[model samples]
Target chain A: MDKVTNEMLMAFVDGELDPAMRKEVEAALRTDPDLRARAAVFEATRQPIASVFDPILNQPLSLPQEGLRDGTEQNRSAVYSPGNPHSRTPGIISWFSGLFQPPKTLSVTVAFCAVFLGGLGLGFLLKAGLVTIDTPEAGLVAFRDDGLVAAGSLDHTLEKYKSGSSFVKTVSDGRELAVKPILTFRDHEGRICREYEITYPATSRYAGLACRTEDGDWNVLIQSPIKSRPTNGKDTVVASGRDADTVDAVVERIIKGDALGSDQEALLMNKGWRGQD
Target chain B: MTEDIRERVIAFIPRLRRFAFSLTGDWDRMEELVQDTCERALTRHEQWKPGTSLESWMCRIAQNIWKDGLKSKKHRAQVSDDSLHFLTGVDGPREIEGRLTLKAVMAAISLLPPDQRIVIALVCIDERTYAETAEILDIPIGTVMSRLARARQALYAGLYDSDTSSACAKAEG
Candidate 1:
C-alpha cells in the first residue's frame, strides 16, 4: 500500500475525497499515529482561521444603494453615471444582455484602461468657452483641461460627411481635423446621431458621438481621449485619457439601438445625414 | 426582478467588504474596494450567466478589479508596506504567549503573503470549496491547495508551541 500523503489527509479533512477514499483514509488514520498527528495539526489550524474571520461575517456594513439588474428590466432608469454623483448612470453590466444599443464605431485609437466609472478623471481639450476648473469633490479624481475642441470637431464632422466619404475640416487655428464616420443610427429618443473619431496628429485625438439637433447642427454628446499605440506612430500624442468604465458609461447612456448595418447606413446617407433633411 | 437583484447584491455587501478587508487590511480601502466592486457588478451585470453562482461571479469581478488597481506603482508600494506592517513588525514579537488568542490567530494569518492570505480566507475562513476558491481567484485548484497548505503550516507554526499543543491534546483527550 502507498504511504498516506499530507494531500490525502487534507482531502479527507476538507471532505474533498470520494467516499471510498475517505473510508480508506479513516481506516489508515486509525492505525497510523503520524497521519493522525498531521491531521490534528491541519484541523487545529483550520479552526482558528475560521474563528478569526467568522466574526467579520457578523459585523454590520453600509449596504450599497443599488443592485444588479437581471436583464428583466432592460429599459429601466439609468442608475450609474461617471462624472455626476447625484445623477444616476447606466449600469455597465447591463450592456451584455442586449439591453443597450451597441455603438456603431468603437474608436480603435483609445486603448481601454481600467478606471472607476463613478469618478472619471476627465482630461478636457480646451477650445473656447468650455474650459472651467471643476469644484473639488469628496474623491481625489482630478479633471484636467484638454477636451472641448475634439468634442466640437467631432460634432462638425458628423454633420458634413455622407456614409462613405471622409470628413476633413480646418479649425480656427488652421489645423486640419479629419473625422471618419464609422456608422450612423437613430437613438431611443429618435435623435439621428453619427459615431466618429477625430484624428489630428499634431493637436489631439478623440472618439465621440455627434447627434443632429432640430436645426441640423451637430452637437457632441460625449468625447474621451484616444490612446495611440507606440508602434503605430512616433509622433502620436495623448492629451487626456478616459478609463474603460467612463467610456462604457457614455456609450450606455446615449446608444438606443443596434449599430446601423452597411446597407442601412448607405441608404440613410443617400437620403441625407438626417432622413427628414 | 431588478429589485430582487438589488436586494441580493446589497446582501453581499458584508461578505464583499470582509473579503476586501482581508486583501487590503485597511478599513477605508476595503470599503472603497467593495463600493467599486458593487458599481462594476451593476454595470456589467448583463455579462453574468443567470444560473451560475452569483457570489463567485461577483468575487471574480472584485478580484480582477483589485488586481487592476494593483497595476499602479504607487498602490503596489502601499500594499507592500501594509503587508510588512501587519505581518512582520507589529505581530511577530507579541504572539509568543502559550495560549492562542484571537488576536494571535489573526496576526498569524495576516503574516501570510497576499496570495496565500486570499486562499486562506476563501477556503478556511469563508468555507468555500477549493474549486470555488480557484474560480474566484482565477487560479488552478492545484495552486489553491499548495497555497492553502503553506498558509495552514504558517498558522500552525505561529500559533502552536510545544506547551500549547500538549495543552490542546490534553484538553481534547
Candidate 2:
C-alpha cells in the first residue's frame, strides 16, 4: 500500500472513510511504526476538552425585559392554551411556565369570553410530529404527546359540555355556530370546573377549560378536543377530563366541595377571573 | 401556529440552555442567549421555511448570537493565566482535576481563536454534524472538516500544555 496521507489517517480517526478505505488505512498503519504513532497522536488529539462549566441545563433562565413586561400572569392565562381545552400538555406547559414569574393571579370570574388563543410545547431534538412553540401568548391546552390544541378549532363535538352560564361558540357546518351558556364553579376540593357543549363545523376541532389563579395566570386545567363527534356506541372514548363517567365524577367533586357556591363566584368576579374577557 | 410546533420548542429550551452554556461557558449569558434565540426563532418563523430541522436552525442562531457578543466581553476576563493554567491543565494539582475538567474545556475554548472555537463548540461539543454545522456557519463542508481538525488540535494544545496538562489529566482520570 502506498504511504497513507495525513488526511486519510485523520478521516480514519473520525470514522469518515468507507470500509475499503478504512481497511487500507488500517493495514498500512499496522506495518509502519511512524504511521501507528501518527494515528495515536491523531486519536489522542480528538479527545474531548473538559469545559469549566458543569451541567447548566436547569440553571435559572434570564427573562428578557420584554418577556417580563409582556408576559403578565393574567395575559399568560388569557391567551396561551395549546392543543385543545382538554389537552394533556398542561404539565409540560406548567413546567415551562414555572421558569418565570406569573404576570398576575388567576381571575376566572373576570375571564373574558373572547380573544385570540394558541399553545405549543418544545423538545430537545424536535421531530416533524411534535409541537414547536415558546411560552405562548395565549391560554394553552397541551397534550402528553406535545401538541397544541386551539380554542375555536374544537367546535364540532360540543355535545360533551353543559355549562350553566358560560358562553360557548362552536362552528356548525360552514355558516352556523352552536352557542350556549356555561356554569364554571369550584368544587369541594377547590378545583374549579366548567361545563358546556357546542356543535362544530365539518373541520376537526378541540375544546378545553381554564381556571385562573390569584396570581393572574390562567392555569390550564383541561384540554380535550373531539377526534370525532362520537356517532353513538361505536366511538371509543379515551379517559381524561372528557370521559363521560369521569365528567360527572369531577362535577360531583366540584359540587361537594362547596367552593363553587355563590360567595366564591363573587370572589372570583372581584379577582378578574370572572371579569376578564 | 400548529400545536405540534409550540410544544416542541417549549420542551427544547432546557437542553438548549445546557448546550449554550457549553458554548459560552457563562450561565447568565447562556440564559440570555437562549431566550433571545427563542424569541428570534419565533418572530422569524417566516424565515424558517418549514420542513427543515428547527433545532439546527435554532442552534445556528445561538452560535451567531454568542459570536456576535464575544468581542464585547474582552475586558472582563477575571481568571488569570495562572488560575486558568491551574484550573484547566491535566495535572496542575490533585484538587484541580475533578469535575472542573469540564471548566478546563470551557477555558480552552475561550482561549481558541474565534474561527476554531465556534467549530469546536458546534460540531465537537454540541455534537452537530459537519453538514448541519456548515449550513449554520454558512461555510463549505470542507471548511467544517479543516476547522474542526485545527480546533481539535488547538484544544489539545490549549487544554493539555505542560503548564496545564497535569491538571487536565485529572479531568481525564
Candidate 1 Cα misplacement greater than 4 A, ranges: A62-277, B71-102, B161-173
Q: Lowest summed lDDT over 10 consecutive residues: which window, candidate 2 chain B? A: B91-100
Candidate 1's error at B14, in angstroms? Answer: 1.7
lDDT of 2 by residue, B63-158 (tens): 777777776675221233322232233333224121225454666666656667677766655556677888888899788787777666566655
Q: Which ten residues in a row have the lowest lDDT in candidate 2 chain A?
A: A112-121
| Alpha carbon RMSD to native, model 1 | 29.4
TM-score of chain B of each: 0.70, 0.76
Supply the TM-score for candidate 2. 0.46
Question: Per-residue CA lDDT of candidate 2, range A5-75, in tens?
Answer: 66567667767788999888866764566776556444544432312221232222222222224545554
